[model samples]
Target: MPLHDFRSDTVTLPSPAMMAAIAAARLGDAARGDDPTVADLERCAREITGKDDALFVPSGTMANLAALLAHDCRGGEVIVEEAAHLYNSEGGGLSVVAGAVARPVKGRHGILAPASIEAAIRGSANPAVAPTRLVCLENTHNAAGGTVMPVETMAAIHDVARRAGIPVHLDGARLFNAAAHLEVPIGALCRPVDSLWFALCKGLGGPVGAILAGDAAFMRKARRAVRMLGGGMRQAGLIAAPALVALDDPYPAHRRDHALARRLACGLAAIDARLVDADRVQTNIVNCHVDDADDIARDLGARDVLTLSRGKNRIRFVTHSQVDEASVDAAVDALADILATRPNWSTPCRESLPT
Candidate 1:
């Protein structure tokens, strides 16, 4: 165990097959729709997600921005889980670029209750109220320690949105991990939503890129939105070629990451049950509660186990293709030793963790 980089799944290096595909790729103009490899990757994305069409984008954030713009929801409201990546992360692209406001609602462990959303939705009947135009959901929700939203829950939320005549968009950055955890076809999860995007980089192990998929008409609008955002890549097959290799067989890799995450979680719990709820981990991220989280993160880094401290007591560890069993054990042992050595390590978590 040299040094375990548990910072994020995005830290994963591209696989050999991915690099080879890039070198052997056939290229053309992607903005003009002539890149054969980009077309192939987009076709594959459409087939997997069961969408009428798909558009490749530079990043998941941009894909989400394109979806927001394409939905024609400017000056409207968007409902999302309070802990959703779209609200907390993404640098406020929803407001700055799409001119849509986010109305954050609370959810239990990152799974939204349909009733909560029903209560939050507003119509234009009152001038003071902004009409809710879209509802966003995240599968394998990030801030809740990678907790998963079940298909039944998704369908229920979609039903609520449908009754309100609001469209639903999924920010499925770790969609493959969710599908693997549920042991379902990826298309099954996409069936209920109006549109969604999934990253090829996280857990899928691509070097870069993501795919946004929706109905043919929506994609046409999204394509123009992508151009408006200056996301047009002339020869984007350079990015898509490697993403194709990621799609070759992503489930196995997703499962592997999940297994490692569980291992890390259970190991951390054994050191001290209060450190983490191992059972809460459904995918590749392990979040632990520790006093002085920044202090602990620094100590762990000095010992060669890299992890991120989120706020006062939360530390996030992501298992990716890069780490193995030895890496996990080393991390667990390092934490155990640190806690044992620290004088005031027994202090309970004081602040509430959001998400």
Candidate 2:
């Protein structure tokens, strides 16, 4: 049997069409802005993100770091969700590289409350306190089971930031997944933020790269940050070409991934409803609360059903372009079989699961 890898959408291999685009792509020095394919990709990114300009970067981490550095030049504070990828995953790049302090606030399913954001903003009168220079929001929040922050919620946060004269940056690594779930144009979701970045590798199926989009002024500063961080790539058309293909028509594949996630969630719920909330299985991430998650992940891996352990009792399964409905079903069956063989395994009470 073929292995079903549900560890992450980032594991997806480039499609045949993407390979063809890469082979036919025109190349030049990206640093000198002569790369035609990179230029096309940047223009396409701006159009999709509804931004005045866009810059291609090596990874999602760099894309977000560059945006943070551009928004907060001096030592200041950035308000972000406590469990956001920037705060929990990015290895302190915002604080160390950008010289910005992170002020984390709790959110409901990764959706920041407007009041919480307003309260976190520091008053300019207090010279001793670090001024809040930026507000960061993540779409399809990874740690929160790929929950999508609604456009209205984003607009509310934008309103708060605008009134405070602070710029808002979106860590939109899975922006397309969120858009696919909402069945809206990608621009509609991007309209509220001053700047945003999305990964081409995750879900989009590109081998590497991410795009940061904003106004030309912001991008000008961001380009400086990119260079400062050693992200200047030459002859980048090889990667940019495939990224362009991923961006052109990502919705169909993303929608299929979401459907498969729902299938996986349903299958798991059948085995044990307490394992996951099927209703919350939105986009391509299915987070389950399992007993001894680490052990279960190990057993599943041995069975050729790869998964990721998020915490003591939490496991994350992500569906991507490479995984189909059959793969999802096989994974579910394998998991069910593994759990059955464990005598100590017992479904937890529904109330014990996180809301």
Candidate 3:
């Protein structure tokens, strides 16, 4: 049987419409700001995010790095969640590439509280320590089972950052997912931050690209930083074209993904109540507890169902735009079958049990 790939949204390929958009793209050098399709996409992004400007980068990672480089100019420190993609998933780009230190603070789930920000700031200060110049946040935080950070929490952190005279950058790779889940406008989820990055390649389902949106001056500097990092592409309209479609297509892809997640989560809970917490199944990500996650993955791989271990014993199933209801049901049935017959799958999951 074919694999029901729920490993990550990045595994999704562009739809047929997206492929058509890519083929029909009007191209020009993006470095010289002449790429018509790219320029159109940027304009749409700026309008959508209610920002003065937006720069299209190759990936969400680049967009986050660009925002950080533009905002944290003074050899400073960045405050981030202990489990943030920027802190845990970005390969230490803040320290290695931006030459800044990440001051990570433990937070509830993946959402950072205002007090944590204030405390982290206070702890990082002194003449001997790097100045805390930026606060980074993630919405639909990946490491925390795609948890959505509430708008109030974001406003509180923004208030704290404002009082400290620091800029806030939101790593909103899944910002649209959060907006869809909260039934709010995407702008409402983004307006409080000094800068924000959103992905075209995630649930939006574009082939490759992300947008970094902010004020005019911020984007001007960020464009330079993107170039310095060798992310400046020529005729990038090829990718931007599909990204534009992904942004404009009036599809409830995220809601569909979330619905499938609910289905999968519910089905998993039915089989093993102690395994996956259906209540924690938010957005499109589900973290299921099982003993020996790698062993489970290997066993599932034999039947061609891809999964990722969140830890030693926690396997993550991420629904995406490409995963339909049939696929979700098939994956769930496969897991149930695995549990019914396999020795390892039948073993009790003490370490992997969801809290």
Candidate 4:
């Protein structure tokens, strides 16, 4: 009667070690920059990302928004991949909060090509157009089944941005997942961008927190943005302590999460090829394309298998530190049972956004 939860890594509960760290952490006013534990966490983040400084924030959305604000991107244009979570899911914070417009360029599986970004640039020659201020990217891109952008491609984009005198901000929500998949150091993956933010919650097993990292000057501005966005915290050591523990040894668990995703993908592909492409699953997420996502999700839930139906014909299954091989197998078995009953559920149809 155990539930196999494949909804998202955000659903993961904190571990015993993280809980213990939280209870034993020292406290101070983090908003005023006096919390020792918060400082420790910030130092750790900076070291990990090879940035000159880092600021801890409450969520990935806030960290990204702060990055934009710190870069003074208001009334400017930010080039982002069309399927990026920042453009589609971040509640339009880019436009509403920063007064910056998003120029969405289509890239293959959430990886933006440097040429595509170069073509999307605007306002440099003409004062009438919004000047391109920042370039945003996502690694282990969510909407594209957790595909990891190559480090080489990152460098190429950075080169193009440098020539254009524009800064780049990376939405590295599942950064560790990308690092583990590529077998590269976190710092190397981050060196090409001006600023980037990574969540301590997803896959890292922290209760909550994200870190925005950049140069000291940019961080000073980002700190102001943090306060303006109501993200200043007192005694935030409670959050930082657990994040520290999670960061200590994160990659191995992320590697296992990637393996679990592949396992789920292979199982789904075996059951029905149209349901998934195992090769496209690069990290912890398995984004399946099935016409009967809603009915399938409901039936699987009834059988104690929880899932997320992202759009009308899409289901997203994310593996995390808490999910095991048994959970993956159980989810596959439940889906198999559901598909057995409805043979024509995978019929070919035109894909449309979720309504």
**What lDDT does the true structure give each of the candidates?**
0.91, 0.90, 0.85, 0.89
**Candidate 1 residue spans exceeding 4 A from truth:** 347-351
TM-score of 4: 0.97
Q: Give the C-alpha miss distance for residue 140 in model 3, angstroms.
A: 0.7
lDDT, ranked from best to worst: 1, 2, 4, 3
Positional deviation of 271 in candidate 3, in angstroms? 0.7
Give TM per candidate: 0.98, 0.97, 0.94, 0.97
Clashing pairs in 3: none
Decide which is better by lDDT, 1 or 3: 1
- Once superposed on the true structure, which residue ranges of model 4 sit more than 4 Å away at CA? 348-355
Backbone clashes under 3 angstroms, per model: 0, 0, 0, 0
Tens-place lDDT per residue, model 4, 199-256, is: 9999898988899999889888999999999999999999899999999978888988
lDDT score, residue 60, model 3? 84
Number of clashes found in candidate 2: 0
**lDDT tens digits, residues 102-208, model 2?**
99998887789999999999966888999999999999899888899999999999999999999999999999999999999889988999999999999999999
Per-residue accuracy of model 1 over 4-62 as CA lDDT, tens digit each: 99999999887888889999999999999899999999999989999999989999999
- Model 3 Cα shift for residue 337 (angstroms): 2.1
Alpha-carbon RMSD, each predicted model:
1.1, 1.6, 2.1, 1.7
Span of 10 residues, lowest total lDDT, candidate 1: 346-355
